[model samples]
Target chain A: MIAKELFKGTIKTIVLKLLSDQGKMYGYEICQKVKELSDGELMLTEGALYPMLHKMESEGLLKIEKVNIGKRVRKYYKLTRTGKKEFGLKIEEFNNFIQTMKLILNPSINQSI
Target chain B: MGLSDEQVDYIENLLKENGLSYPPLLEDLLDHVCCAVESKMDDGTAFQVAIKEVLNAFGKDGIEKLQVQTLHLLNQKKQLMKRLSLLTLSVLLFTVTYIFAFPIDPPNSSPLKGNAKITAEFGMTFNKLKAQNQFHEGIDFKVPLGTPVYATGNGVVTEIQSKSTGYGHMIVIKHDDHFESLYAHLSEILIQEGEEIKAGQLIAKVGNSGASLSPHLHYEVKKQGKKINPRDYLTP
Candidate 1:
């Protein structure tokens, strides 16, 4: 389980990175993507995800479009130009973080046995 | 196997009182919680117990945190408006003070020599009229009755009279640079005798005075034995 503070800061980066790759995604779709990528280890509550998405849209980092899907209107979010640039920087930072964590978690694996 | 109409109504009213509009995001979260509670009730749990479990999952602090963020955003907007209003007010105050405190400069600095023309016109004109025979000294200001009269130059107050025989309420400021200013026919005297005064320090309000016709201030600038026209040194 991810610590709340860590999850709070990275949630935006994670969403932006996913949208960068996936073109556009709705609320539920984005939640599903996070779960799948983390191999069911991460679960984002709707309570947390929607507010972050709304805040990002207000901040001009994301843009939203609404589409009618049968009985309901599904709101989809896509990265804005600024968001695309931010996504690149965040991905690089996340990759560096993952590499650092791997080194710390299993120092023996990279060293002579 | 669902929330009864009465329960849903109660929940909706509670959310409304909390100031949340039924936006899609909020509605979806509420609907999911309601469904989860209803499912538990259908499986033999009591209504109250199921509702409690649903609320626990929602977390008490989480809802409050969201509400606080909305209120904080509103408070920040109000603070910005207040700051803007204060800034505008300060600017207006500074402009008014600057206009009154500084003497109006003439279009061109032309020189005047020996007892030039001066008019003791409006508020202090009565005092000028009273002194017309007895050396008819000083120029009068044609300003509003209550306009704050300021010192003509830096000086020390020689006399400040609340009520005297000739000048009614008045002030006499003696300047270091060999000049004396006499302000008479005042509605109120603001300074004290022998107190140091600066140019543009408020000395009195304009008023009718002893042997006068109407409200006005009697202003005099004297250097040695000469009664030069006060207007020569003043800007209108």
Candidate 2:
């Protein structure tokens, strides 16, 4: 499981990138996608995911539409135009962060594992 | 089969009291947890164990962090509102005090008697005089110069003099109740030697005649000849 503190900042980016690529996704579907992408390594609890989604929606970064699926009403979230721009910026930042982390984590990586 | 309506209502009320709205996302999350707990119970899991498991999934620090953020925002708004109210109240209080309680002085009690109805009020001080130290003695009320200044309550006129002192023209009324009232920087005097007058009666008018800053009646009251805070006696 990912450390809670370390995950807070990146969660929004993760969600935004997934929605940007997938076009639209409901809550359960997004959770399933994350599980598959992480190869079951990263599991996001509903408690954390829903609040972030709601916050992003409130901020106008995401738009929601409700569809009646069988007996339940499912809410699907899609990225807005502003969300697309933000997604690009976040991806760039994340890439830089990953490179920095890799350098710090394995300074002698060029020599051995 | 699930949590009672009363429990849900209780939780909702708690959130409301904390100035948090019931957003749909939080509602959906709670509903899912409740349903999962119910399912576990149906599968022969103990109620406490199911509840513990569901709460554990939320993570101890996660819920607390979210609550703290919400509460911090609420508290900031509340503090700003409280400060604004206090500022408005202080301005209102100062206005009322300025209108009602003007011209306070030696610092003493008056033996003569008369009533002052506060006609016009303003403030005066020697701030620009470059004196070693200065303080505002009283608020000045404009009535008429030498308009027979009266005692605020029952007090005797203890000191009466006319010279180039701080108060060029002044009258000190001493009261029998160990209180004194002072009227200073006057144009003329109306009452005779040791005479008594009733409250609200004409004593003197506003004047610009003494070490006077402007044309206004300077007034003061004192308990035991000691200047008490005049603001405490004025009515709102």
**Lowest summed lDDT over 10 consecutive residues: which window, candidate 2 chain A?**
A66-75
Residue-level lDDT tens digits of model 1 in A12-97: 88889889999998877777789889998788766677777766776678997777533234577899998998889988999999
What ranges in model 1 sit over 4 Å off?
A: A68-73, A101-113, B1-19, B22-55, B70-236
Tens-digit lDDT string for candidate 2 (B1-236): 65566644543453344344546544444444556566678999976787668667666555555555544544566787799999999999999897666433322222123344443333344443455445666555655444555556644555776776577677776655455667777777766547675544456545676665566576766676666555455433
lDDT of 1 by residue, B184-231 (tens): 888777778888876666667777765446676677766653565566
Which structure among the candidates has the greatest DockQ?
2
C-alpha DockQ for predicted model 2? 0.12
Task: State which docking tier applies to candidate 2.
Answer: incorrect
Against the true structure, whose TM-score is highest?
1
Question: Candidate 2: lDDT over CA atoms?
Answer: 0.65
TM-score to native of every candidate shown: 0.41, 0.39
Q: Lowest-lDDT window of 10 residues in candidate 2 chain B?
A: B105-114
Summing lDDT over every window of 10 consecutive residues in candidate 1 chain A, give the lowest-scoring window.
A67-76
